[model samples]
Target: MNIHEHIEKWQVEDGVHLFDKIKLPDNSVLIDFGCGYGEYTISLALSKKHSTVFSVDKDERMLKIVQDKIESHSITNVRLIKADGTLSIAFPDCYSDMILMYDFIHGNTQEKLPIRFKFFEEARRVLKPNGILSIAPFECEYLRDSSGKRRRYSLGMLISEIESYGFRYSESIDGAVHFDYYHSPYHWKKLNGEMSFDYLEIGPVMNFYKQK
Candidate 1:
């Protein structure tokens, strides 16, 4: 599918429902961390006219694509940033209403944990009190530690890791496609079938909140 088709599916077909399920505030300041091609960034910008959205990525090329989209649509509420690293996020403490970490947590090697850890710490610092921290680590793979051993991080483990950085686990939302980057039979079952489950170990997006 072309970018236009993908954007349509995201806005009209699936992505809107996903953000809706998460109860994204209509007038919040959102930072799309590691935003690739501005899928969630653009959707959230259009999701509410009063809200401000920042699309952040390490790749200039990806940011350019999002810039093109924003300009073509005349979306003034969205901003683009080329990430040098998490330390370069540039937002002041408690500045944003939410930080989005979607499809971006893979490739965490032992040597990379400190950097990723700093990223999470930055996420915590930038969010306002009671601000949301939304994460959907779609690549549910084993994470490597300093010793080079791989550890299979379950949903609980993932939550624990995030909470270790001073955030509180809130809730998880199911049945919404994660920007077409993630899908699971678990969500499909709950959406189409009679299966009634409060939470799935391997599906949906996880949510957290900054307590302080």
Candidate 2:
């Protein structure tokens, strides 16, 4: 299958529609953390025609995938950064309008939570006022292995940790929830107490946590 089809399969397998949750402002500068290949990144770049996008991933193999894409499509608006997920990203203060962590935290083990939180803290620092942020948590951020299929997290830890970084709050997408994530409205509600949001709840939707 092609990338779109693959992402769809991933959506079904993981029960999340990452692409749909995000709401981009015109000319926004967006970043896709942990962007694997260039599927969603390219889609975001193409969709947000006037915006600049940064596709960040530590895996060098995927760089070629993304490079092939940006080159083939002749798209100049994306910047690819190679760095460790938990390390502080090198960007100026308040530099981004949107940041996406697609299955980023989940990949790190418990030992890395500090680093993960640091990334979030740094992300919050660099985010512009009212900037958007999205994360796709595939179960516990600490439990790396095959357990995600069995051990589901409360999302409370994830939410609290993220909120502690100083993001204000926003609503969630709640209609037809993504079929892949296995998380319900209750999960989102639990994650963001008293925070409200708009939900596409459908395939390819984005789940946004705006900068306070």
TM-score for candidate 2? 0.66
- TM-score for all models, in order of appearance: 0.77, 0.66
Question: In candidate 1, how many Å is residue 178 off?
Answer: 6.6
User: For candidate 1, what is the lDDT?
Assistant: 0.72
Q: Number of the top candidate by TM-score? A: 1
lDDT of 2 by residue, 166-210 (tens): 765455543223322322457457656432222223322234454
Which candidate has the highest lDDT of all?
A: 1
Model 2 C-alpha RMSD to native: 10.3
